[model samples]
Target: MRFPSLVSGEFVKRINRFVCVVRIKDKEHFAYLRNTGRLSELLKEGTCVYLKEKDKGKYSYELLLAEGEKGILVCLDSQIAPKLYAEGLPAGELVYEPKVVGGKLDLLVGKELIEVKSVNLVRDGIALFPDAPTQRGSRHIDLLIKAYPKYTPKMVFVIQREDAYAFSPNREMDPIFANKLKVFKSLGHRVVAYNCKVSLEEIKLKEEVEVLWR
Candidate 1:
């Protein structure tokens, strides 16, 4: 998806999960961070980042993109996955945040219940998800598992960078979530991962990558 006009900045420090300090043109400013993941790999001191100015808020700018290894632009907005997924479908074929089976799923394309996850951490050409422990993500998998054959369950991992050639669950960070994914796949559910072509102007869904579940 296309982004608003972005300003280049240098990441200074993270004040909290939702706020970070960035230097734009030698002036430090507090920016809103939409992703709660522990982005230790990307958000380092003096790292180059892109931000969108906010009209009226506690923070003047919102963090949108960050430069990863080898100058790859990684999307930091976690909420963009469903929007990117919806963009690939025909009009009226995709539903956003639909309530199903007692819980809300990311998107519903026909009978398919899709749960989209944003991934930013890439190591050794492999993208891993849930940079931190995510009980909420595990719960989403459980909801998909519960839906079962009644509704086709799909777990889509969107790697918001172009460097990753494969995707895998961070088993060391959240084994429960990894195990739940295994169970879901064992039940004949679908698990897919796709890498994106991210730039300062926009981020688009690229080709599907190998899902390395081990």
Candidate 2:
């Protein structure tokens, strides 16, 4: 899972509405950014970045894919999907056969296939997920277990570390996500959540981040 289009060594500005950011070097005084979700990480007020040249655009800039670990996170996602197929535990398998629990799942990972989600709301000491109600998200955990007969299913919630020192679901915002997590655990397939590391040199994101259940 290599990074598709990447920008290296540029000054980053705010990324409102999923914009791309880059530096023009000798000619301009402003940052260059594009409009695409492909750019990893939410563009913030002052994102550090560089540039990857592409065919000319109207704005003369290519999207700045997150470098370092963000790039790795993209790679990890594609790689893990297949690796899970190969090193599957009883609970994990690469069901190339593919199952459509409802009408939404992209891949059914083992017994508890999950839909990947990125969370982006954080402030003060709290982090919020979905930022909107997710009908599919709630259904995903439910289907994970429904797809299985013997064991519980799992939902992998991956988040990047921001300002907070700890992590938990934004129960107040998406109470259903939290409630469903509890239900899943009661059924057996516990909801697993983990954070990706972000920095200047590397970004390794994971649908699964190992941690203590307690």
Candidate 3:
């Protein structure tokens, strides 16, 4: 994703509550804004960080991290994921629209009108998505199935982090999603789990990664 006013400088301090204040000059202060792609460890109290400054916030906008600094966007999936489809195999006919029969979708991949879920919770080489309960996640499966009776639309839980070989639903936290995913498999629709190699630079959709299914 492209961000405006990318700040390539050093980290000064995390001022206020969420603002990561940086020094571009003597009187210039650059605060790290909260955005989607920004990670926790990337912004240290005294670490060199690249950011994008936006004027859309009263106090701050967000900092878009450059992946090249850490090379997190290199693989996207399968740096730790199992093996499903190949990476960079060409997103042929993979439509990018949001339309579900019973509900709404996130994006479309060809005949697969799918929903994309981004998980940020990671621990010891494992990352789980939907840190909280998602009634919508459980419902997406039903909607996808209804959208394509001939072929079940795929619902991909895209884990957007690093150092994981597989992906799993947060059954303990959201058993509804887990149970629905387990039940949905009988319909012959695809439930894909993939990991994203993220950085301050870019977040890519990778192929040739591994997946775990019930």
- Kindly report the root-mean-square deviation of model 3 from the true structure over all alpha carbons: 6.5
State model 3's lDDT: 0.54
Candidate 1 deviant stretches above 4 angstroms:
none
Task: Supply the global lDDT for candidate 1.
Answer: 0.93
Best by TM-score: 1
Candidate 1 residue pairs that clash: none
Q: Which number leads on lDDT? A: 1
Residue 127 error, candidate 2, Å:
5.2
Candidate 1 or 2, higher TM-score? 1
* Window of ten residues with lowest summed lDDT in model 3: 74-83
TM-score of each model, in listed order? 0.98, 0.55, 0.62
lDDT of 1 at 21: 97
Off by over 4 Å in 2: 1-5, 8-97, 109-112, 121-128, 150-152, 161-165, 199-202, 205-214
Better of 1 and 3 by lDDT: 1
Q: What is the lDDT of residue 136 in candidate 2?
A: 64
Each prediction's Cα lDDT score? Answer: 0.93, 0.46, 0.54
Roughly what TM-score does model 1 have, to 2 decimal places?
Answer: 0.98
